[model samples]
Target chain A: MATEIVLISLLKILVVVLTILTCVVFLVYIERRVSAFVQNRVGPNRTGPYGLLQTVADVVKLLMKEDIVPRNAYKAIHDLAPIISIGVALSTFAVIPIGDTIELFGRQIKLIIADVNVGILYILAITSLGVYGITLAGWSSNNKYSLLGGLRSSAQLISYELSMGLSIVGVLMVSGTLQLDKIVQHQTTYLFGWLPAWNMFLQPIGFITFVTAAFAETNRLPFDLPEAEPELVGGYHTEYTGLKFGLFFLAEYANMITASAVITTLFLGGWHLPYVEYVGLSSFILSLVYVGTFCVKVAAVMMFFIIIRWTLPRFRYDQLMNLGWKLMLPITIINVLLTGIVLLILH
Target chain B: MGSNGKIIRKKDLNFWQRMYIPEIAKGLRLTITQMFKPKVTYQYPDEKFVPPPSFRGRPVLVEEQGVERCVACGLCSRVCPALAIEVQASETELEKERYPIKFEINMVRCIFCGFCEEVCPEEAIVMSNEYELVFTSQEEAIFGKEKLLTPIEKLRPRLEWLKNNR
Candidate 1:
């Protein structure tokens, strides 16, 4: 039975990995479309309908292109960089519960690949491994620009991670569980009558802090200083090309989707909607709807991210650092205290 | 209250302010407004956008009264920074007269800088509002006289202006 369960988990992991890969490819297309619309320009529309398969063409082009490893690059580490990136990215989705369990082929299958108690911690560890790729890619390139980008990315991640981790402490406190699925189960109630089952209502400060730190953690604007063009040509991936470079690209976007999913699960009440119980809907249809809801929420966060990219000017390195350590850290600490005080009073 | 200088403004935020209630409320209101607001987005191809008149676009060659108004001066070609314009002119049946027989503009190379239009002596080539010039193949995009020239019937108003003057 244990062996069978392991086999089932393996199958689920395969599906989840494929899903994440597909999302990364399609997300690029979505970003281009969204950015184009905002700038009053028509984006890619040649490959497929509305240029849906443009990413596929791009993938082909990148794959066919020359694979140049810089002369001075540390061969083994450079060779292994993208593998680490994609490995971490693909594996991080293991803990992401896309939906509730569904019964199929006389077997019950949980929506996620793994049901780990330390799900959030697993995510943090996996995501942090992405910096290895960036650092190695930059150091391998032996370019000044690439070196700066690598250093910037590493420093930025470490700085923002404090606030990010702190922000989630509130959620863990309120929900009283580190397991994400149970956290979802907890969001099935109302505050008064009108208020929905969203932690965003109760822990607004925590939500803000979480999302703000999340942007920085993902190296997204206005915290995308690591890959800031005009200053650093192509950043850490400057020397990478073909399928190796493709891995880094995939990981970046996959991390983005992961971050979005994490945010949705933590603060926006995961798949739980208030007053709308999953009673009559068949588990299959229910999961389809649940995954659909999950995707929609993720897409919305992704859109919000892109809009901020367009709307907000990129912060200077100092401003980013100061914002992370000074403003955000203090705010997160305060949010934690407030959450504790509220929880204590309510009890 | 007396030791105002010592205490930082943020050191003592009111409950509502510290809670970020006002700002979050404002953000929530704005999001709701955005939800109801008619989307300014226009879906291209499926729903073609009507670009404003001043929207600068592709350079179009104009043939007026069945005669190319280019004058073969090469001003548009020479002045074009992108060097996307190629004009091959030949003498007409009319004595000592030269008109562009083969006018081609490679849009793949054209920057749409509007310099070509500005430098045109006879206003033969001007930027058009038709932005749907994307082509799959290079041969199709490197437009020849057949595909390049806007018919005189299409440009009667502008042609008549040229006719009334020159």
Candidate 2:
């Protein structure tokens, strides 16, 4: 029984990791194509059917490049930074429930890799650690531009992390739990017998603040001051080449996927297809449908991320700080208070 | 509006604009609509861009009825800012009397300035529409009379353009 449990856990980890890696590869391709479309120009379509294998080609090319280390650089720390970045970005997926518990091999299994009671806390903690990677990379590279980028990123994360956490506090108050699966399960219930009790509806201000903060956390455009090419010249990864640079690139998209999945699991209904339970589908088919629904929700959120990146210009440094501290922070605090009051009254 | 000229401050934006969400929505709508619109990419290699007669390309000597129009005046060589043209005058049995025995233009030195064409009194040398110039070696870049002579029919558009423009 113990062996079986170990094997199941291993299988789940393997599946989750592989899925996240593949998603990162495709996300890069989709981002390029979508950005091209937004600008009224055709993107790379020549590299294997609408540039589907473009990211794959890019990875192979990155692998072949020479690993250059500056003479004045802290060699060990520089090497370790991308690994830290990639590890933190990928590990945040462990607590996100893609689908509900399902029967497999005559045994019940939860879809989440790690069923930690404090799932939301784990995600918040892991994502915050992502800044260390950029900061260390900047300091270790011994480059002025890289140092500035690293400093900006750390500041940005600090400013935004508060609002991000507070926004989630609003969701937590409504859901009454920290476990991601439980939060999703709470959202599965109907409000007023017709409206789905997704946190997006229950705490609209929290949803907006959370999404904005997620964009900042992911270091995407508008909040992508870390790698602002015009000023920073590839930012913290300025001195990075070959596979180390590739790892940082992969970590970014992986972070985007993690953010999207978390948003789906929290604010959106995780794997719940509204009114699907009444259709009377078989258990196995129902589970499959639920997984599909989860995937679709995540994809939609990711598409929103990509479109917003192209649509919005990067925030000036002062503007970013003002928005984060002055605007988002207060708004999220208010959202948390409002959510607590509503929950208290309803109960 | 006072001393600031036409500069619009953030405070000047009325409520909805200051909120930024509604303004962002408008921007998103514009971008999303642009996504479905026709792309403006020209697939090169598969699709070539043909230059018009007005375009100044590589200079060529006009060949008329199995003979060059050049009277070996050496004007184009003297006028060439790049000193690319080399004319060695020699007597010919043709009606022009004087012909270039060793007429050569070092493309390595040629700047495509069209000065040689502009100064040619006989209108013998003119800029053609052929711009694809590639050479592996310095020797290959030096065009002798054999390589420089282009038939009058092929030079018609350029010759006509020069006639009208001049």
Candidate 3:
């Protein structure tokens, strides 16, 4: 029985990692296509049939390129930086529950990789560690531009993480659980019988704060001060070459996917479709439906991320700092207080 | 905040503008609308761009029937700012009295400036609509007479364009 459990768990891990890596590659392809559409240009249509194999070609190119390590750089940490970045990015998805449990071969299998009780906190802690990869890469590169990028990334984290934490606290207060699966279960209840009780509807301010903070945390546009190409010239990963650079690139998209999944799970009701229970499907079919629903929701969120990247101009460094510290921080704190007060009055 | 010579004050912004959320929404709306708009990309090589007569692509030597119109006057070499054109004159039995023994255009140095075409006395060199030039080596980029000469029929549009526009 124990061996069977171990085998299933191992299978689950393999599936999750492969799915995330594949998604990362395709997400980059999607991002490029979306950006092209926005800019009124054709993007990457030559690789293979509407550029389906562009990411594969890109991977092959990156693999074949020369891996140059600077003579003045710290060799060990420079090599370790991308590994740390990608490791943290991929590992954060372990707690995300894609769907409810399934009964197969007369035994139940939970969909999540590791069902940690402190799922939200675990996510926060792991995401915070991602900054160290950038910081260490910058410091070890022995390049001034890289160092500046690393410093900006750390500062951005410090300013925005507080708001991000506070925003999630509102969701936690409403759901009354730290386990992510329970939070999703809490969100399954409907309001007025037609409208699903997603956390975004209840705590709109927290949703906005969390999403914006997620964008900053992912080092995406408007908050991508760390790798501001015009100013910092590829930033912390400037000195990295070949697959090392590819790893940083992969880690970024992976982080974006994780953020999208978390947002869907938290605010959008993970696998629970609106009025899905009314279908009255069997357990196995229902689980499949739930997984499909989760994927669709995550895809929608991912599209939003890509759209926003092409839409807005990068925020000035001071503006970024001000938005994080002055605006988002206070607004999220107030939102938490409001949730607390409402909860106290109700119960 | 108004220390710069521009003298823009931060206090001028109202509460909504200062909040920035509404502005961001407006930007998002603009971009999303743009995504639905028709793209202007020309898939080059698959669908070649047929440039107008006024367009100056690579300069070519005009071949009329079985002979080139070039008298090898060397004026193009003198007029070329980039010094891209080189012509060697030799005695010829043709009516022009002198024909180019060797004509080479270092395309790497050629800026597509149309000066060579403008300076040619015999109407031999004119800008053709052949813009796609690919070379794997520096030597391959240097066009000899075999590469530089194009049949007048293939270059009618550009010649007609040069006639009307110039």
Candidate 4:
């Protein structure tokens, strides 16, 4: 029985890791193609049918390039930085519930890899560790530009993280649980007999603040001051080359996928397909449908991420700081207050 | 608004614009609309660009009936701003008696300025519409008479264009 449990856990881990990695590759391809379209140009269509294998080709090229370490650099920390970045990015996916618990081999299995009761807190903590990787990479590299990039990234992430955490408090109050799966299940009920009780409807301000903070946390455009190419020249990864640089690129896309999944699980109703239970499909088929619905939601969120990247220009450094502190922080605090009052009155 | 001679800042944006999300939605709508529009990119190698007759490309000597129209005047060499052309004239039995014993154009130095073509009184030198030039070495970029002498039929469009315009 113990052996079986261990095997199931291993299988779940393998599946989730493979899915996230595959999603990262395709996300890179999708971002390139979508950005091209936004600018009225065709991007990377020649590699494989519509440039499907472009990321694979890019990986192989990165693998072949020479790795160079600067003579004045702190060698060990520089090498460890990308590993930390990718590790934190991938591990944050463990608590995100993708689908409902299913019966397999006469045993019940939850879709999440780690069913830790403190799932939301785990994600917040792990994602915070991501900044350390960038900061260390900047300090270790013997370049002024890299140091500045790392500094900006740390400040940006720290400021946004306050609002990100504060925004999630509203959802926590409404759902009444810290576990992500519970939060998702809470959203299965209806509001006024028709509307899905997604936190997005229950707490609109929280939803907006959370999404804005997520964009900043993921270091996406409008919040991508970390790697602002015009000023920082590739940012914290300025001194990185070959596979080390590829790892940082992979981590960025992987972070995007994880962020999208978190957003879906928290605010967008997770794998709970609205009104699908009434259709009465077999248990096995329903489970498959649930997984498919989860994937589609994540993909739609990722599409939004890609489209927004090309639509908005990067913010100036002072402007980014002002938006984070003076605007988002205050708005998120108000959202938390409103959610508390509403929840208290209803209960 | 500018008639008052005062600068209006982005901060002065009315309530709707200052809301930020609605303005962002507007920008997103514009970019999404652009995505479906016909792309202006030309898929090169698969689809080649054919330049007009007036386009200046590589300089070449005009050949007529298996013979060059050049009188070996050396005017093109003199007019070449890049000093890319070299001519060694010798007496010939043909109607154009002053034929070149050796004519070379160092493509490495050629700037595609078309000055050599413009200075050619015999109309023997003209820029053809063949722009795909590649050289692995400096020596390979130096074109001899064999490479520069292009058939007149292939250069007819450029010659006619020059006649009408000049």
| Most accurate candidate by TM-score | 4
- Kindly report which residue stretches of model 4 are placed more than 4 angstroms away from their true locations once superposed: B1-11
Q: Candidate 4 lDDT, tens digit per residue, B25-72?
A: 999999899999999998999898999999999999999999999989
Per-residue accuracy of model 1 over A211-306 as CA lDDT, tens digit each:
988888778877888788879998888888899989888988888898899898888877765555536776677767777788888888987877
Order by TM-score, highest first: 4, 2, 3, 1
Q: Which regions in candidate 1 have their CA more than 4 angstroms from the true location?
A: A282-284, B1-166
CA lDDT of each prediction against the hidden true structure: 0.80, 0.93, 0.93, 0.93
Summarize candidate 4's per-residue lDDT along A1-347 as a digit string, tens digits.
88987898899999998988888888999999999999899998989898899999999999999999988999999999999999999999999998998888887888888889999999999999999999999999989999999999999999999999999999999988999999999999999999999998988889999999999999999789989999999999999999999999999999999999999999999998999988999888888899999999999999999999988999998999999999999999988888878778988
Q: TM-score of predicted model 1? A: 0.74
Docking class for candidate 2 = high
Per-residue lDDT over A1-347 for candidate 2, one digit per residue giving the tens place of the 0 to 100 score = 89988899899999999999999999999999999999998897888988899989999999999999989999999999999999999999999998988998888898989899999999999999999999999999999999999999999999999999999998888887999999999998999999999989988888888999999999998899999999999999999999999999999999999999999999998999999999999998899899999999999999999999878999999999999999999998887777778778978
RMSD of 3: 2.4
For every prediction, compared with the true complex, DockQ reads 0.10, 0.80, 0.80, 0.85
Error of 3 at A80 (Å): 2.1
Give model 1's docking category. incorrect
TM-scores for all predictions: 0.74, 0.94, 0.93, 0.96
Which candidate, 1 or 4, has the higher lDDT? 4
Please report the candidate that would top DockQ against the real structure. 4
Candidate 3's residue-wise lDDT over A1-347, tens digit each? 88987899899999999999999889999999999989988789899989989999999999999999999999999999999999999999999999999888887988898889999999999999999999999999999999999999999998888999999999999999999999999999998877899999989999999999999999999799999999999999999989999999999999999999999999999888888788899999999899999999999999999989887889998999888888999999899999999999999
Lowest lDDT block of 10, candidate 3 chain A: A270-279
